[model samples]
Target: MAYQTFRQEYLQVPPVTRAYTTACVLTTAAVQLELITPFQLYFNPELIFKHFQIWRLITNYLFFGPVGFNFLFNMIFLYRYCRMLEEGSFRGRTADFVFMFLFGGLLMTLFGLFVNLVFLGQAFTIMLVYVWSRRNPYVRMNFFGLLIFQAPFLPWVLMGFSLLLGNSIIVDLLGIAVGHIYFFLEDVFPNQPGGGRLLRTPSVLKAIFDTPEDDPNYNPLPEERPGGFAWGEGQRLGG
Candidate 1:
């Protein structure tokens, strides 16, 4: 896909992207207040148990440590991936991407809370991002000027390293399993026309969902007003 064309086609940034970035900013503020700690929410059973807050599932993504480099690196990675996805599927329809990202994170968190309670704090976000990157592996990136492959298998390498470093391999495995299941489900119950055909044009939404389609919405430009332009063109100059 032509990156320039894709970028040109997108007139506006997706709402979900804006919302996510805003949340990250807010998290940074909260962290500075010392009112909350990112790591505490992840591994502390007491914090989770006492607070009993459900928002942690989603808020956890926004939590970055005080380490400026780590936080910047994560934000850059997220921006690159999200921009590629948003541009690739034009019309700024980010509903599905947002849904999948959050849903994947939620699933990972729940799995951590239950199956791998020991690594709850250590492995949630990384696993979720790994799974997402795996499923959408065709999206490539250049690492340090060297062409590095991503999308399908690179996630495993990351997961392996995380395991070697003594992080929760179990949560990573669970993420991979869930990602595969999501892929299979999409293949089976495919999105069809007649679903949200007006506001978004069902074909656009289908592409956003990454569903296979017999016909695709390739008209990247907005539709022209019927006969309106022709009438204007035919009129005498300055009349």
Candidate 2:
């Protein structure tokens, strides 16, 4: 009965979010089971180019260290923001969402070459949080009930929190950089005078994943950005 309930809820998650979160979980579980080592999953440009271990490009973003508080925290934020983005901004636009994934992954992969990050799953999560916060700037949010700020500041707050834990800041910075690039190109630039969309979703992707023909007249649903108010030291960051 418990398994059935879990499966039902899991099946209800949006496709992109479901796939990503599931991949992260399975990768972590595999590591825990000793079926795969982080050494085999982490990013290595040399291995990718020389030996053609192309899977590393993706597996790098699928492991988030051994299961612990950090893993739960990242998974919570990742699932929440990623789902909100898909069901909110990218509603009925699966292909475009996938394209954004491709674009962000590509940019991160290129930048990862110069950085010392092994598993970029946390960074990728930050990127999702950054984009979601930017799109819903008016939303009120609080961090662990100690800090109250607007939505746009959530990413920075997370970075600050990570700093407190003594983790390297490079990962956070990389996420913010890539997220800002995506936000500027997709949301900011197109709205500017005489500026057109620089990141067009490829037709092939559309044909493969989704199509305009799916709906002759499609209206976007409301943004699923979280909104609320609370007092006390809540571990989660939400508004």
The local distance difference test score of each candidate is: 0.49, 0.83
Worst 10 residues of 1 by lDDT: 223-232
What candidate 2 gets wrong by more than 4 Å, as runs, is 211-239
Point to the candidate with the largest lDDT.
Answer: 2
What's each prediction's clash count? Answer: 2, 2
Model 1 agreement with the true structure over 67-173: per-residue lDDT tens digits: 47546645554443354444443334455665556556666665666673533322434444444454444544333333345445544654665576575567557
- State the local distance difference test value for candidate 1: 0.49
- Steric clash pairs (candidate 1): 137-151, 137-152
Error of 2 at 90 (Å): 0.6
Q: Of the candidates shown, which would achieve the greatest TM-score relative to the real structure?
A: 2
